[model samples]
Target: MDISDKATEREEQDRDIALHQRKPEGPAATGQCLYCEDPLPPGKRWCCTACRDDWEFIQK
Candidate 1:
């Protein structure tokens, strides 16, 4: 494609990415695992990565 067409395509791609991006929901630090309710320190959302993944999966 020509320079103008390529520029338009890039703009469209950027807009698509911006539209799909999402901000984190809920509290930043709940002091417990969101999925399993396991105890955790402050500033932690999940006890482990697995719990975090499961929480997100269930949310979807």
Candidate 2:
């Protein structure tokens, strides 16, 4: 690819990474696991490893 093409590709990759890391926000942001309905800790997002895996699969 050309230099400009490579730069565009990198930008797209960075956007994808940022989207993956972004979590839900707002009044709807309940303190619950992303995959399971279980409650999460103060700053937690997943209840267990399995739930995390399932959430990732769904995200994909």
Candidate 3:
């Protein structure tokens, strides 16, 4: 299309990429502990060190 349309499309693509990159990956993204499946506090990935250790073990 036009140059203006190309610029808008590029902006939209950049926004989508940023949003995707900011999203958490793996079980942590679901707001539960990666191992125990317990509810997590805001910005927490695991409920405790045990769960965190379990996740680390599984990843290896």
Per model, state how many residue pairs clash: 0, 0, 0
* Model 3 lDDT at residue 54: 86
Of 2 and 3, the candidate ahead on lDDT is: 3
Shift in Å, residue 22, candidate 3: 13
How many steric clashes does model 3 contain?
A: 0
**Considering lDDT, where higher is better, how would the candidates rank from best to worst?**
1, 3, 2
* Candidate 3: regions farther than 4 A off: 1-29
Query: Candidate 1 overall Cα lDDT vs. reference?
Result: 0.83
TM-scores of all candidate predictions against the true structure: 0.54, 0.48, 0.49
Look at candidate 1 and give me any clashing residue pairs. Answer: none
The digit string of per-residue lDDT tens for model 1 on 1-60 reads 499999999999999988755445755667888889999998788899898898888887
Candidate 3, 1-49: lDDT as tens digits = 4999999999999999899668455544467887888987766778888
- List the global CA lDDT of all models: 0.83, 0.76, 0.80
| Residue 16 CA displacement from its true place in model 1, Å | 26
Model 2: per-residue lDDT, tens digit, 1-60?
499999999999999999976876422335898777799776577888898788778876
